[model samples]
Target: MSGLSTTWFGVIRSTIDGNVALSDINLGDPDGNEIVHDTIGKNLICTNMFPAPQIGDADDGIPDPSYPFSTVGRNVIGQCGFVLAP
Candidate 1:
């Protein structure tokens, strides 16, 4: 028997208020293995993968002001500039 292996790579950019402007971004990867330089922000290498957090209404049917929930937290696999590999 033989084992199989595969690899994947990509880049991610994020902002605090989801107001990041694309015009300020300029990214290019001279080498396929990694990014050479980026003007937008720091470049992070892919490390791990996990399911994003889930959001739902409160048990009492009332929104909690202290712990409000939003769609922004959903579907977000990682922090800003996070990368994932398969």
Candidate 2:
């Protein structure tokens, strides 16, 4: 994912259900690609798959206070975004 327009977002409002394994999503992959603007929403349980963000938790896969989010710390959106401890 390279040469994206300024108006486009890298990721937004995505959901991950049971049994799906994900990690390091768009973590400077494809040689030299870094998702600068992304808002991802996930519905996952427990451990194993985690978005290992290197540009700080708030700036990477995790949510932060930006154009998409109104405030800081709150990354996940929607009711399903909340994960219950299993």
Candidate 3:
């Protein structure tokens, strides 16, 4: 199976108007995409976007449990960013 490691930076806060605003999230690589978990009645409750897992299998290039990490569909925290690996 093919796997991918991605790096994404973004903020996280309540969707309410004028709420306690969280800012400045600099997540490193192996960080997966954002995951929206709505336990509460509302939507966009929490921003669960962690980095991708360390590449390589248990020994070889086998993907770990956290495979197919994507940087798509992340809510606007405040600002977001990403840098291309040279």
Candidate achieving the largest lDDT: 2
Q: Which ranges in model 2 have alpha carbons more than 4 Å from their true place? A: 1-12, 23-52, 55-63, 67-86
- In the predicted model 2, the residue pairs found to clash are none
Q: How many Å off is the CA of 85 in candidate 2?
A: 15
Q: TM-score for all predictions?
A: 0.17, 0.21, 0.21
Stretches > 4 Å off in candidate 1: 1-15, 19-49, 55-63, 71-86
* Candidate 3 local lDDT, residue 5: 27
> Model 1 — which ten-residue stretch has the worst lDDT?
50-59
Over 1-86, each residue of candidate 3 has an lDDT whose tens digit, in order, gives: 11222355322211333322222323554543332211112212222333422222221344333332223233333222221011
Q: What are the Cα lDDT values of the candidates?
A: 0.24, 0.28, 0.27
lDDT of 1: 0.24
True-vs-predicted CA distance for residue 51, candidate 3, Å: 8.0
Cα lDDT tens digits, model 1, 2-76, are: 121223222222223332121112223222122111222332222222121112122134544553332232233
Candidate 2 per-residue C-alpha lDDT over 1-86 given as tens digits, one digit per residue, 9 for 90 to 100: 22232321222333323232223333233222122233333322112212321232334455554524311133332222322211
